[model samples]
Target: MQDPVEIGPYPRKPPVTIVDWAMLVLAIVSVIYLAWITFWHVSDDIHRTIVYVDYGVCAIFAIEFCWRWRREGWGWRFPVRNWYEVLGMIPVTNPAFRGFRLLRIVVVLARLGRAADRAVGDRVTAAVVNKFVNTIVDVIKRPITVAMLDEVADVLQHGRYTTNIANALEENRAELDAMILERIRKDPQAGRLKFVPFHDDIVRIATDTTFRIVFQVLEDPRTDELVSDLVRENLDQIKESVREKDIVRRPGATR
Candidate 1:
């Protein structure tokens, strides 16, 4: 991650760049002025000036509210758009609930402090990207690997198997075609064995194997259903690959 920029130890003033000193003095003076106007003033002229000043402060705060709204992307609706912003404009709402509005100002100040701290700490996006990449690597290189291969095998086998119980018995289907083919070629039931394929057995093995392999790797509901469908499809293929046995064994009988 890129390092954060530091901005601290505000250098001591050697007259402190007149502009800096001016801003500091103005801020302190404004606080003292507001205190006097709010608590001690009784003159009409002073009252009118305080009203104008309050409007000015309200304008500055409005601009800040707009800026923060944009910064948050203005992507979704919020329950409340800052009480201070509401108080600054809505007379009835403000007077009726000024204390609540004031608390919002405290929250806004706290948020600004947090933002400043983050600005001096580190880049947040870089860490998020790194964590995302790590998780992807872990999933693809570990348990997901085993599930993927088993899916391939299931697809190849389901083409030869039965899809339902009625189809298994009444249709006279070859459930274990691939397995039986391999066994037949190896045992060469030439004239001795009776080979009858069992659809139930073939479907059972393929379904069980596929479920065991994929259940742990997938989490999304849609993906889970897809995996199950794929396994069933593969079991159907295996049913179609069966053949009968030789001699003493009728035509197709499988162990």
Candidate 2:
């Protein structure tokens, strides 16, 4: 039998297990600790005592990142999108600024919820660990995104894209065709034109949807007012021009 091809870190989705439980606990602790830091502000004495504890939790995430990278086998890329987690590893002597912590409450809670959802593994997307952490994380990542875009542009210039594309198409062709056929069959509006080809269906749907939108806009009172104003302006101009012509022309001359 042919071995499965390894594409990246998560070759296949991992099942929920004790590790997920541990990660969930760590996340809960992190949220509580952050809340304490946010509302009450950790003092120097307490910060010194729990400093290693903070480092230890951050270390676990850092190791997880490395573990995932190593598991990628041959096909691997740097986890640039996860740049936020690195902030967690940085040991701060003082609590983060009060204003920032207040802002991060929603972000931190949102990530914690994602972690919880992952543990449950329902109809939601699978995720683990904190979404790399911090309110400032978003603001600083625009430049990184640009840099990543540059890497993409660079790869497009040199990567074995056509070979990869051919292999992907070859592997998924049956499933892709099935998906197209299924979508066409399932589409309520397209069912009427069941005889239409896939491309034709797409074109018909887009054209019909856009045509309906245009008609709706034309029927709108705002559009009606705009057209009315435009017509009135043109009629007024035409009337003024005719009145001028009448004043200048001889009484018997053809206007």
Candidate 3:
């Protein structure tokens, strides 16, 4: 649907996505802070500071959630549908549910992966996305708590899920062709450019091949294992470090 919100001359798309660098940075901060609180023992002063900072993050997320809720006409179902952002808003000061921000990472990663697929090859794009995701998750691995990356991956990569999308395109094929022809004729460079009739088979082949390549990457079984291993490795390393620290602090031990 076209955005109802009007710019000077045209309608812009709604702000359904909130994945900018500023928000991503805040999320990374939120996730790291959440991890620190979850995995490491902190002094009261440090804990208070974390609460102070996260309170701000929580307020921002809440405002965004409400804005989207109103704009999308999601009504009561908005919170249920957007439960991830809701998690970040549900008392960032409390620290128990501050992981909402990291969903930003998943959003960006998934989007970037798709964009890369359009810009380059599909298998190469998937491999790059998996590596990048592993690196970020690995960095936050020490505090990484979620275990269902595969679940989200499954949601993105269901088999034959784009059948409806292709059907819709096919249904509107004539309208799409007319719109393209009109735009081509109206272009300032129209004199230099000839309008070529868009073939129905062209649309079918393009959509089918694009979806196939993208889903092939998403359906990879190894994604789940890679995510699991990163979390496991980080936790083990943190646990060992804590044990060593405890031993050094023990009484009657050599300096």
Candidate 4:
């Protein structure tokens, strides 16, 4: 058999660029300016100036959001998740909702935090989070039965799953066939057997005998009935065992 191939580590995402940092700083400054103008009453001229600055900042954020949305395969979920950015873009004169523009700072910081986590190898934090999530899943998970598994498998095998598996197998059939042939050729006994006199005849005879035995067994009238009876008996035993266990575990059951 061929040795297993060693896969290299996944390529790391490119680090945050200089332009990203500049944009983040600009966003933070704009948010601070917007907050000041909204909460503390400024002169009409100053308020108008800050409002214009806010509009410019909002435009920059809108462009950035669109770029990211496109980069992420044009998914609508991006805007759905980052609703604060959308809210910030809406022109509202009310100072109460004007603070929504500050949410843009939160979004920027959150993105920076995630980038930092990725940059710094945060495997321990990831492991801890994974363990916590797994614990919760384990607590909520239900026990599975063979019959349940069989039903699920049947549904999947009869549906798209079977088609997908068939397509994959068909695609790789040539490679799989080549691998099998290579393995057979590399077998230590294969070369010795080839040199044996009447080796091909012996192989054919052995194969025929095996096939005849299998055919006879399958053709026997009792074979199907015997197998069915055995399976039914085992199922009955399993059911009885489960009932006994349930009775023993009952709240008021006697020891």
Candidate 5:
């Protein structure tokens, strides 16, 4: 036999077993029989026997409900959520209220439907949805427009790109100075300069002055505009150089 399907608050075992289904069927039949007796107004001994059967069926349900409640650790929520079941299981002379147990049929059918969907429909639905999305994306996608590319280029060219670079350089100035000093100390040509009494002081002053001059030059708005204009003018030459190199490397290309 297939393994039982567990759902809801049941932790260690399946919430509904074969025995639970049997009890459910019994509860449903008892409700229908009680309804029949009420409609026909039966006053015979058979009515008394049916009444006892009704009590027996309700007892089974009450036991199953409590068993599930404790097993699943549902705490107080069980009574609140399944108040209908609680009412149906209450032993009473009138059969009118017993009809409420019929709702259990709806609950059972819903659970079964959910189980079936989980078993097969979930995978089928996901596959169909994935294919549909892929097809739509492949059909609708297009290359980015020239306007979009121009907007991106403008941001890089005229935005705070250079300002951010200058800020980063300022932040790492100490580290950069140390790296330059290390390089100078390791150089053979700088041996004479290292022997000078104020070598460290001279290097610090020179490095700071050079950094300030470069930073000022780069920070100038006119310098950025000039560089942009130069690149724009030479764009054709850059493209031609790349194409020429590509052609020269081709299998049948002549010198």
Candidate 6:
């Protein structure tokens, strides 16, 4: 069996190479060719010119694509190769596949620009674009926190549960205030309040009085009992945490 032939080193490198310049000029000329075909006369002369232009652009792009594929180390793989490197050969597919082709152009341009920037010791354009894109995204996301908090507060003020609580408190304000006053009067250690807090503060209201009416369901003896139970539970948790902290700070407390 014959042994495989090995490829030698690249004959030329980058900007100094005529092949690279020719590829770029061919890409530019292809744009002109496309414009001519898109808007020129239909005489045989014009048709022939467009045909030749297409053929020339196709040939140049094919050669450039093949060279890039091999240079990028895709010589060994068979069908499972660098398919993206050879995109320009399919011209008719360009309209439907314009995005894919543009991606290939981006890769080539990025490579060239990166090399040029490295040689000149500057990537100012790339850095500026990156920063600008990041700033735009940050600006778009800046209002998300305020929007979320506003939504939470709105729900708490107008939701069915809160609305029910508000209605119950308003309809039975005298009874509710009597409960608060009785508790404070009976227990000197009870939490102090200048007056029973108004229900409007806890719910949506639209009157000069600013007083809210609790829904009848919440004013029901059963639901009100449950609310009282929950409030006590929460108060117990708070008192426990405070007592634990106070105990820890006592003079002879354990570490």
Residue 246, candidate 5: Cα error in Å is: 18
Question: lDDT tens string, model 2, 76-166?
Answer: 3444433344454444423453334434555455445534544554313223333443434544444344444444444444444334544
- Please tell me which predicted candidate would have the highest lDDT against the true structure: 5
lDDT, candidate 1, residue 170?
31
Segments in model 4 whose C-alpha atoms lie over 4 Å from true places: 1-15, 91-255
Worst 10 residues of 3 by lDDT: 8-17
Candidates sorted by TM-score, best first: 5, 2, 4, 3, 6, 1
Candidate 6 C-alpha lDDT tens digits along 31-148: 5555454445466676566666656676766675566557766656621333322333445323343334334343344444333433333343355446696674555433443444
Clashing pairs in 3: none
TM-score for each predicted model, relative to the true structure: 0.24, 0.35, 0.32, 0.33, 0.36, 0.29
- Of the candidates shown, which would achieve the greatest TM-score relative to the real structure? 5
Candidate lDDT (C-alpha), each? 0.43, 0.54, 0.53, 0.54, 0.61, 0.49
Off by over 4 Å in 3: 1-19, 92-255
lDDT of 4 by residue, 104-180 (tens): 34444333333343454333333444669666444433223444434444443334433444466557756755565
Weakest 10 consecutive residues of candidate 4 by summed lDDT: 7-16
What's the lDDT of the predicted structure labeled candidate 1? 0.43
lDDT of 6: 0.49
lDDT for model 2, please: 0.54
After superposition on all CA atoms, what RMSD does each candidate show versus the true structure? 25.4, 27.3, 24.7, 22.1, 23.4, 20.8
Q: Which 10 successive residues of model 1 have the least lDDT summed?
A: 239-248
Candidate 1 TM-score, true structure as reference: 0.24
